[model samples]
Target: MKPHVVAAASLLLIALAATTAGAVTFNATDAASGTAGGQRFDQAVGLAYASQVLSNASTFIWSAFNQTSPADRKPVDAVTLVVADVGGAPAFASGDVITLSAPYVGNYSGDVKTEVTGVLYHEMAHVWQWDGQGQANGGLIEGIADFVRLKAGYAPGHWVKPGQGDRWDQGYDVTAWFLDYCDLLRPGFVAQLNAKMKDGYSDDFFAQILGKSVQQLWQDYKAKYE
Candidate 1:
């Protein structure tokens, strides 16, 4: 009878040990159990997203520039996107990390998955994209990111006609839409433009593809769309 009780206890202890081993581990230093703007995502999915972002960013980098080989690629490491509590803030890019303050990840009945993924893809582009020696137009910088997301087929349903803004590099959805037009009007226009940006962006790069200045191209785009 004593032997039977000891064996049962040993089995229970083993089961508990196995369960503990299977639990997910995180190195969160600031995560609270119940915070106003905190949530947990699938550990595996989050990691996969990070991997995809890096891979795609690498592709964009290599293709967007004249880098002869992987050795010539820019130094990019450790891209992180965080979900935090920020009220009514549109997405913004920071160095190496972009924090998205969501009202709630799953509360929205809309296309939350596409929306989130699209935004992440856009920001990830910014992380890997070169800003043309800090001389690139801010609007164009944003447009390029959106162009990649659009190409990836994650574009949201709300994008409308391009060239509606007062200027060409309006950024975000505005520039994204215009880029789509450029892709249609001039095949591989965005890809070549991306490569130019990778090496130090210049407006003259537009003339290489379109035979006109970026301002002229913007005017043409506006005339066509509007």
Candidate 2:
């Protein structure tokens, strides 16, 4: 296994212990009820985020979206589709809970045990990550969160390899792999960068971390993989 994968696996073992113990509490009634996948998230993420019961599916969507939206994430029934459609690519729709589709969650033909666990960790990172007040590039925002998931030991089986992609900021595993390289080059690079984004993303944040411009960093990152 790659070093990042090994590290992430170790981290997941530790986090899973804590996650299972109800360290993060959320309202249960707020989430989708009677849905198998929804229930899985309720036990895995919702219970971990807050100890409260999710009243129902609509409530769950509202609570997650409202937490992140500059405007209140009004309660809506429309989010049921979101919960059902978050496939291999997980994203926050309308700035609310990180939604993921099933394909992204697991091997289509295999048992979903590992896939769900890994995706949950990744999606949960999005829920908590700071996005530089929309000033940060969306790709970078996603990269950072995936980096956390990479660190947390929940990266998927397919993420075991890195490659040459369109750009370092192509997002998802592509950017995530670049961030892993940065972590190796500069320990705590991802953590420190995340702190910077919390204050509203700025290109200068790159200079602070690596003493290089963002463009320069992207170039270097791309070269490493290419």
Candidate 3:
């Protein structure tokens, strides 16, 4: 081959590599920089640390979902985190953006950085995980996010123990524990469930994956601990 042609091919390869590596970009902003909570965030969880967590959480979520290739994952080009004086929940995810409550950060009495990291992980899971195209159970969606947080080893001390929830889809920690039980029954069950949820959700998904209804599985899980 000609030298110029070889050089052009090399440049093309480099460009492709850069594109692949830059598929997902993370950004963080201290929107509530003037607030006490915002100051706490700056001291304990700066924009750089938050951005890093976003990247790390994305990588972890991909692996947890068994999405080995770009084709298998959601096409999210960017994820942005904003620390602001928000009310209600400590943090929430909307589309690809995550907003952390400044008040929550300021008032938290424990390791704020670690707590924020866990929150980011849960929110990042929402950014990546499919929601049965908006047809899945709300509790299951939240549970899956918490499940990802649980698998990442950041589950908080206050979270409920396995088999303690009133139902399988009670949401948050309760649902997360149940999902963990389901995953144990069939290794990679969570990943499989997430993949199936890409298009839609059905109660029968539990039966299809584990040959048992979700209710029955919940009963069995409770029995083990009871």
Candidate 4:
């Protein structure tokens, strides 16, 4: 979305490199097709819309992460969405696959379409994010995904406001809000951090990019809102 931060080619190059014409195969299935949530997903969300959202979220995530080159992103050939009869979290992403809980979808209040789109945005980020080859903190990885959701303008209402969390790496929306602040301080802060995390992660990365430890940055971030 920040077209001014980088060239249009950077935006176009990486996304188009994921595969042939950036053609990511998307498949969806409802295992609990008889349940209320399954019905909700079918009637409200549907497979076609979910597939489109997947593609769009892919582009948004690439742009949001500042992955302007083929080397900057994961080479994903396909992704799948399965609606299952499960409980707890609404959805989760593993490898190149995503699963949404039918019960959660059935019971959710408010705008179902908008909410699911946000969920898809968050989960899809996991499909493409590096995760330091499984060496990074799980929480930070999740936070980065939420950072993508936030950047896509799909953040939910219940999330903590800016500077309101107990720590910078608290994960989910807390770390997401913190990362958003860091991105403001140094444009492409998340992207640079992610790039550094391709091999591994270090608390020192905060120091490297922002000239201060993450703890110090958190203090400043918290103080700004006081």
Q: What is the TM-score of each candidate against the true structure?
A: 0.69, 0.59, 0.90, 0.88
Model-by-model lDDT, in order?
0.61, 0.52, 0.89, 0.85
lDDT tens per residue, model 1, 48-125: 453454455446544644444645544644444555555555356687666664454434447555566677677767
Instruction: Report the lDDT of model 2 for residue 61.
Output: 26
Q: Model 3 over residues 63-132: C-alpha lDDT tens digits?
A: 9999989899888898888888888899999998899999999999999999999999999999999999
* Candidate 2 residue spans exceeding 4 A from truth: 1-24, 27-107
How would you order the candidates by lDDT, starting with the best?
3, 4, 1, 2
What value does the lDDT take at residue 65 in candidate 2?
27
By lDDT, the better pick of 1 and 2 is 1
**Model 3 error, position 78 (Å):** 0.5
**Winner of 2 and 3 under lDDT:** 3
- Candidate 3 whole-model C-alpha lDDT, 0 to 1: 0.89
Instruction: Show how many residue pairs clash in every candidate, following the order shown.
Output: 3, 33, 0, 0
Residue 217 displacement (Å), model 3: 0.3
TM-score, candidate number 2: 0.59
The residue-by-residue lDDT of candidate 2 on 1-226, one tens digit each, is: 9999999876554232111111232221222323555555444444334222112222332232233342332222221113343444543433334444533322244435445445544555555556777788888877765665666565777663675566767787778887787667778677677666766877787678888776787778777656
